[model samples]
Target chain A: MRWDFASVFDNTDALLVGAAGTLRIFAICLVLGLSLGLLVGLGRYSRNRWLHIPATIFVEFFRNTPVLVQILWFYFALPILLPFQISPLAAASLGISLNSAAFSAEIYRGGIQSIETGQWDGARALGMRWGQAMRRIILPQALKRMLPALTNRAIEIFKMSTLASAVAYVELLQQGKLIASLNYNPIEAYTAVAVIFFVFLWPLVQFSYFLERRLRRDE
Target chain B: MAYQWDFSPVLANAPLLVEGLVNTLRITGTALVFGVALGLGLALLRLSPRRYLSWPAGFVIEVFRTTPPLVQLFWFFFAMPILVGIEMTPFMAGAVTFSIQSASFFAEVFRAGIQSIERGQWDGARALGMRHDQAMRRIILPQAVKRMIPAFMERAIELMKTTTLIATISYADLLFAANEVSQKTFRPLETYTVVALIYFVVIFLASQVARLVELRLARSGESTVH
Candidate 1:
């Protein structure tokens, strides 16, 4: 029950492996999630039901469900339902990426919607096509506007990577749990993991604030 | 191992799930009330002219706001007990963590709401011979609280969703109940689907209530100023 910082760090390489796994999953999910989010966001605003309804349902289903459940479903239920087998890491990444997409889609939609109607009119007045206006004029500004929300979501996605540990994905928390089980020192093991997370998370938090202030000043 | 989708086991265990749901609501409700109170105090402290008080208050808000709630919950449930030599039951630990986590966000909401009120309003209150505390109590807080309703409602919805994290610390909340059923029947899909549906109903209802409140507030012509 005593604090044992040295014990936790004795196998530092093992912990670093867990950290590397955490970073890998986070990076993969961020890229995939952001891409999917843009598609879903555009789909939500589309006039056709072909695009909008499915995107709407996807957003609602993922957004409404507990993320832990979503992780469990992908990691457990999907294999039985799917034709081929997937690795645990793949399942966890897919689950996190898809859920993050649902949220990011909403963020992008909000950012895009916040752009003024006059700006759209102004673009039209300049004889730009819809796609041209969106790509060249609207999206840049919208993306800039969404940087705060996007950074917050990225941090959230990074934190949620820990949930992958629940399904035995051997992320930082799972590694901590393994050490705790072995050593019967949950306090030290988990606290060390928490400190690791805090170290990773603190910079992102500061960066987001700095970016927000800079953006405000720019405006 | 093939997992089948089955609801019969979960349905038979309805009482357990219902009990968990009740506990979930209890934790969320209690946490929301206490969090709001703490948030208001913290918000006021942050706005205070006293540098020592406001600086620490600001730091606490920043720390809590940035860290994941799961990490905070784990630290409180595990670390605090060892450090303080006081063991908290899982329910108590979850409640305390949720309250502290919710307070940080609510404090930010409150601070924004308070700061949005024009300086002219404060000057006007001062000219009427009202002291600072009296002006805040009678004029500023009421207006700030009104302007804050929409944001506060959104935060409440978020807090409700976050209550599921209590399952991590052995609190028998809705998510925990679902996990129990899933383990018993190995029907992760069905058990979680039902759990998600329950959450959707609660949150959707809350969203409706928020809209109604927003409508009522707008009708009263207070929302126009913001």
Candidate 2:
């Protein structure tokens, strides 16, 4: 069969809706994943066994498994283990958030560990408590140091959200597939989806570059 | 419905999984070899003084580096046939996609390694009557390749992990086998856990190989440093 660009363009509203859904998932998961990552990162670095073991296991399991499998597990396996049923959207969000947390935890740990010992010592010498020092001094610097990496992770999570389509979530890719199946124009539909990703992703890439340059200048 | 944990069902399908494991390694190994070759070429192209050559190479690097590999893979598998009238088998599609996606990152790694070599080395090689290619072949590349070992190892491990994506397009890799078993046996958790363990083993072995190369490089570096 021949390619049809006109047919794909004719269904622009459907594609736009899918793009909106993708952005929503990305925004929600970014916030949730970063928060979870911070907690787990801090937990992994903590001396408490209660915090460390669980955090380590969480990071290792998610990081090691293929994200598609992890998405499958959340969508299929979790409801069997848990008491409550979850919507596919919720499962997709949770899966992405959890997977991203594993990666972000490592990034945060690296950022936090990169802070000089003298910074902590000085904070403590200034009569700040451990929490006070971490919250007031170490964390601010670490966050700045980590901004570039964190943004990169956010972009990754956004890309990975497309995998949710495999589990039957009507994200951008899923919508593209639907359009392709109906129109029998896989190339144009998928290409359109890719362009949508490119448009959305290009800004994030620029932002990451800007952050990296700014961070280097500050250094 | 109560679920019972049964390893036997998965064990019965071990042969399929084994074949899948072999296929995964085959794809990873082949892609790594070709990817490095392509990457080296691209790196040289980028470092070439000629802007006409380097600019296009640079664009390829950025496009592949920024775009997700899965999307690229789909484009290769799905779009290439329409665009070029050449249909690729799933395995061929996987290999080409992996290699292309990998070349970009490997090119960056190699470029960084090459740049780390001092300019004095180039001048010294020129004074010794070596042609540009000869100088690079005999002097520059040996040192750059050695410095690039760690980064290349890290990328290899990443490539190993990423081979799982091949399963998406129905290549019978370990991940695809796990999905098959999970669907048939309804024990996705166990099937996926086993698949993850197998990946860990493969990646761990790749890491070990990296370590050995690193040690060998260090020994050579020490001898040269003296």
Candidate 3:
């Protein structure tokens, strides 16, 4: 009948460790997912059938399935094919990174496509190669438009770090589980976890919204 | 030695997988219906002229949208029952968590769709002596609902994918079934692969259908809301 956060406060060290673990995976997935997404997005934009087809398939396959399934598959199924077992961090990171890549590829593609054909023509008129033009001219401009969406993706990746706990990874949610079980304070334990997440993510969400509004205003 | 791939064990447990899939769909359907209805209510309250109504609705939407669904699920499944002094089944917890989680998302879609309607329609209805509720029901909503369809389908597909998380709470959804089959048959590779493929096929097909609807809406010259 009484709400007590004292137990949760006493376990601050555990939560801090969990926060570090969550941030580690989030950073790994964010960098890997978004950077790789640029390549896959380019592939989707490519005229070459080889590049386009495989990119399409990759995006479709990864985007279509639930990410937890991917993590579990990597953790349980993939080890059988490999010479060694997959670490929880590796499996969770791979699953989240690939899923984010698939989703973010579309964002990248849409951003690139939103650039007018005139931009491409101007780059071509300047004797710039495709890669040079993409890097110097097209992407810089497209990235501005993609900023809101990409930030949204980053927030999503942060939230998804919790799924690492499902594999018994030492993440925020996993640590929360440990604390709750040990202290028998599920209410305080879980509430603290949720509040911690909300504290971390609310600013990012607000930033994305701000970016979206600015983009809308500019356009 | 290369690991040998085997499918016989997974195939032998087709019925279990099927039941798991059915449970998955059941949760998705239950959550989708409630999510949409509650989303509409939330959106309406958010759009209310009164600050008291709009503020609380906005708060709910923001909190739900900002937090991780897994954390929400855990809180509901593990924490809520004891707080309220009642027992909750995994299904109940999953349904409640997903419904509210998805409703927050759907609320935005509804809000955007409603706002996208030209202000002239409302003025026209007013000129025709229609009350606010009457105009909303008869004039505004019909048009907004059409624009919202593509977004609705997209969110529904997302909801289905998200339902997989219930397995972590020991619900016998498709992913949980895969775990069971893998352990029982000692064929984790084949079992997980089959389950993943099943998810891929169903979700991919749903996505394609959503795309088709979106394309059709575009061709019909009806601009849709996200």
Candidate 4:
């Protein structure tokens, strides 16, 4: 058997489209997941039972289950309860974003909790409200510590974006599947896909390591 | 129109779901045992004084860690057979992929755990006429393994969740069984929901156990490694 990449190179257009789809979903999930996570994390940190109970439940349920299951649930089961059919992208996005939210919520909570009480007290002494204190003082400091974890989460989200293909969303893996089936070159096609992912993720993984090392040194 | 919720179809397919769950555990168990053992070996090789052994181990860990598992799965399941001239079953492919995948992660944990031990301990061992391997086997590993329990449990749980990906390759894991039952019953909602809940229960219990172990470790005043 001989190794050939000519077929994969000829299908660069398909891979490019898949790359765009993967990036699109990654951006969507990053924004949705992190922002939603902040709210849920605040809920988890809240003093009220009303906020805390539901947030805890949400985190536990999503975190405990496999992400693919969540994606499948949104894709296949969710539409039955709604008036309209769900798009593959929508289903995939919802599942990935929500699942990411659950994981990142813990990061947010841990970051916030790690803040020294002295800082919170200082904010209160300055006559700042809870929201003001959190936004102006707590989050800024917490964010530095959270940066490594959040970067890790972003990488994870990028990787998880491949699951969108399970719902027939036009991601890199889905495109690879298309290319392989069409050209009958599963070896080159899948190898290309794996290399593409490694190339895309290597820098991010390095950045995360840099952040972690820097954080460890600084702290 | 109110679409009435029905679980009767899912309930009737209990046997299938049970079998799926068993397969899931089987895969998880196989992967966990091999992953930990292989992980330790990789970690030790990575920690080697020789460049050749360390470099290859580092490469394997980094490559596996860097790429997505599904891509690896596809490469192993679809791409591997042609290249190696051997037929590959889904279970075989899934097991191999996950064992190496989880092993890469476990390698890091083991490396950290081993490194976390103070240099004085090694010095003490060497001063006691213990050879490197002798010190590592008896003195270093026992303590490292204790600190590593929480991280190991967490990884094992993650591995279980990851086993769901095998379903994509047509492995009759729980998630695959869900798809089969859902199509058969024409009750996607009930079937998927049931499977999700089943996953939730099993994983939740496992997580609770992990948490309990971590808590016990903490209470016992053991410093755990991530």
Per-model TM-score versus the true fold = 0.91, 0.91, 0.99, 0.99
In model 1, the clashing pairs are: none
Give candidate 3 regions above 4 Å deviation: none
lDDT of each: 0.84, 0.84, 0.96, 0.96
What 10-residue stretch in candidate 4 chain B is worst by lDDT?
B65-74
Tens digits of per-residue lDDT for model 2, B1-226: 5666677888889998999999988999999999999999999999999999999999888777776677777777877777777879999988998898899889989898878889999999999999999999999989887788778888887787777778888999888898899899988767876777777666656667877877887787722110
The digit string of per-residue lDDT tens for model 3 on A15-58 reads: 99999999999999999999999999999988999999999999
Residue B118 alpha-carbon offset, candidate 3, angstroms = 0.6
Query: Lowest summed-lDDT stretch of 10 residues in model 4 chain A?
Result: A158-167
Those runs of model 4 whose alpha carbons end farther than 4 Å from true positions after fitting are none
Q: Interface RMSD for every prediction, one decimal?
A: 2.7, 2.5, 0.5, 0.6
Q: Candidate 3 residues B66-109, lDDT tens each?
A: 99999999999999999999998999999999999999999999
Model 3 chain B: weakest 10-residue lDDT segment is B1-10
Q: How far is B173's C-alpha from truth in model 2 (Å)?
A: 1.3
Clashing pairs in model 3, backbone N/Cα/C closer than 3 A:
none
Candidate 4: docking tier: high
